[model samples]
Target: MRRLAILMLLPLAACSSSAGEGTASTPAPPPTSPQAPAQPRDLTTNLAVPWAVAFLPSGDALVTERDSARVLRVTPQGQATPIGKVPGVAAAGEGGLMGIAVSPTFAQDRFIYLHFTASDDNRVVRFRYDNGIGPLQPIVTGIPKGDNHNGGRIAFGPDKYLYIATGETYKTHLAQDKKSLGGKILRVTPTGEPAPGNPFGSRVWTYGHRNVQGLAWDDQGRMYATEFGQNTYDEINRIEKGKNYGWPEVEGVGGKPEYTDPLLTWSTDEASPSGLAYAKGSLWAAALRGERLWQIPLTADGEAARPVPHFQDRYGRLRAAVQAPDGTLWITTSNKDGRGDPAQGDDRILTLPLP
Candidate 1:
């Protein structure tokens, strides 16, 4: 692998302020100056289809395997141990045990949450992890599921509410249905009820997404998400409360007045984006089909600058990118996910230091 160097560019006056949603605009030119080189090191190898990563308060990480439904505890020293397999996972196609999140108040609650494809639907559940996984308690349930597009990513925002990303389950009409949990980002309390200040007075935060797998928040608490586009373009969207992303109605930058546009978009061949993380004034997106990491720099005002791509084809298929508690970036590969040609030690987690 080659050394990765990021350019810290100054914000341009032409850059749109992170205000209302609009179509993808021209980005500012790349910076003339370059930062120090950052290199990625494989933290663990020979893992099954690892999907999501969450960091414990102790600096350890909890990783979920999509097909196996197993959770592994990974130490900072690169040691990986299987803690337990979540029961009742219906591993198929793009569904299974997908996302895992350590509670923001984990030190006090000892609760870890998971999103998985059950027999009937995709659901979120929590278990108290003292030394081992406790009995399961379902929080959010009845999310639509399908052989594909089983959007399953969960995280706790800075507000302490749990946010969920759900797919339309190949049912495009569901994207427009606020009453349906499919194709929407749901915000709920710890107990799975609708959050107090939710837009629709229910769990739906935003709707009209085809398949959103990545969610991240900037320092200012602004939310962003990565969505898989249907054969045309992939998107990085600046999420707002109750806004529709125009999924089946449109893809990429529609420039339609009624629907919000994406902040950035790439051709499907260049980016099947997933697992987004915010760090060092940039949004890092892991690409599955593109087999690279994209660093999208942000201005002081939170507008997006030119995006830089790194590690193209060096790693087979990148699935997840997350910022660790210690400030390093951790990413997982997805070569073993049936769509890619597996390399030696096909599925693995790699770590890189940020500038």
Candidate 2:
């Protein structure tokens, strides 16, 4: 494991002018230079179907393997040790052990949350994960599941609430139906109760989603999500509390007044976007079918500019893109996930410089 020092980017401070009398105003700082292109470094190469990674305060990480139902504790040097197996995980097409998130208060709580496919449906469970494994405590359950479209990205938001992203389960109408948890992003307490002040007085936060595979928050505390489109386009959306993103009703952009149009969209082949991370005034989206990493520059007001693609077709089918606690980005490849052709060490974690 090679260690690199990262330089933090600073914004220019506002300059104030004194009242006249030969008083000169100070000049604003020069524009910051673009970072040198990040060279991808292989952290680990011998992993099987690794999906999501969550970093601990100690700088160690917890990684999830989708098909194996295994949770691994990885050091910064990329040494992986099996912590324990999640009980009763039902691995099917596009499902299994999907997303893992550590508790924000993990030092005291010692809790880690997992979203996975079960025999009957998809669910979120929290476990007391000390260095040793403990019992799995079910939190949110009964999310509709299917062979595909089981949206399984879970994270704790800036509000300290747990957010679960769920797919519509191949049923288009579920996206528009407010009653079902399918095709919606849910906000709940750590104990799995509905968060207070939720729209419709339930756990559902936003509705009308086809399949949302990513959840991220920018520095401003604004939430963002990535969506998988049917055939025409894939999407990145700015998520609001009760807003509905047009899924079944509209695919990409709809001028319709009822639903919120996506902030950005890409061709289906160009972006089957999965995990996303907001860092350095941009959102980095990991593409699976497109097999690229996209960086979307953001304006000061939080509006998105055109996206710039990096490492196109360089790494095969990028699965997850996350900013580690150390301020560098870590990404995983998914060529071994029964989709694309796998290369030698097809499934490996790669580290990149901060955006």
Candidate 3:
């Protein structure tokens, strides 16, 4: 509840240049595997258990490590520096330092937002970094958390609202609870107040989600989310206000009439959909258990095509995939940090140039 002074990092104009050009508005072709397109010339490697990656106003990238609780400043030249450590982070089985996003008004106020597990709950906090004085202070808190289903992803919508993703944390019914901020997308003002004009009158934007981990917006202002399913299916949903994504009631793509079905769903073994990003008019999803990058072409409406796998064995256990400031897709490997088999470099971030 402590109010902290805000600091800005990069200006809006600085971000517009890199962001507006990288992702295209045209429809992308479906991914083909039997004959993988020749790998792009630029494929930068070396990152570790990178839970999330955010682009700074200055065009650099901020990458987070789930188990390390460390926030790294990754440069365009591929050099990474430890910016600062996150506080109140509880690390363990699939729980730890999770998702991160830069404030929309980063130029005027260098505020950084983060989602991580605390001792008792998973919460969102905003802080400022000034080099000498590490992390500034807490911006928000009081989110529910558990070992397995702790959804921790945050992004800024085009309207500049901060959208937070959360999980039910084993409490299946919590997803449908309006009062509780769990298993749903939450919309809030930059300062953490419930955003005005929210569908539920509360922070809840949509409900009935299991463990939503990734979120992104297209040029057309459409929102897409990637979710981890319980047993059968993993989903890529085109999110709408007030809609419920079937969770405990129905596993993945199909569910009750009242709930909205996913735009694309993959079997559990094929995709444990985690991090997501929109690049070149297509949605790219990172899979943990599947260990591949699923490139999903979207129709103008935002419904995703059957996913096309990219870099299946080349990259180990893809965790986070974000469009970088350089117009290239930044992907993080999660083989290290104790989850998947540790690839020599285990947790490393890679850059893939887009066409």
Q: Which stretches of candidate 3 lie over 4 Å from their true place?
A: 1-47, 132-136
- Residue by residue across 1-355, what tens digits does model 3's lDDT show? 1111112122212101111100112223435322333463323355556789898888878888888788888778878888777877889777799988888887888888888888988888888755422564654577778767788889999989999999887788998787888889999998888899999788889998988989999989999888877645667888888898877687654535887887666655566778899988788888877778878766665655445688787766777889876788877877775657775655677777766
Candidate 2 has its poorest 10 consecutive residues by lDDT at 15-24
Model 2, runs deviating above 4 Å: 1-36
Give one clash count per candidate, in the order shown.
0, 0, 13
Q: TM-score of every model?
A: 0.92, 0.90, 0.86
- On residues 194-245, what C-alpha lDDT tens digit does candidate 2 reach at each position? 9988998999999999999889999999899998887565788899989999
* lDDT values for all models: 0.85, 0.82, 0.74
At residue 162, give the lDDT of candidate 3.
Answer: 93
Q: What's the residue-level lDDT of 167 in candidate 3? A: 84
Which candidate's TM-score is highest?
A: 1
- 10 residues in a row with least lDDT, candidate 1: 13-22
Q: Rank the candidates by TM-score, best first.
A: 1, 2, 3
| Alpha-carbon lDDT of model 2 | 0.82
Most lDDT-accurate candidate: 1
Model 2 / residue 39 / CA error / Å? 0.6
TM-score of 1: 0.92
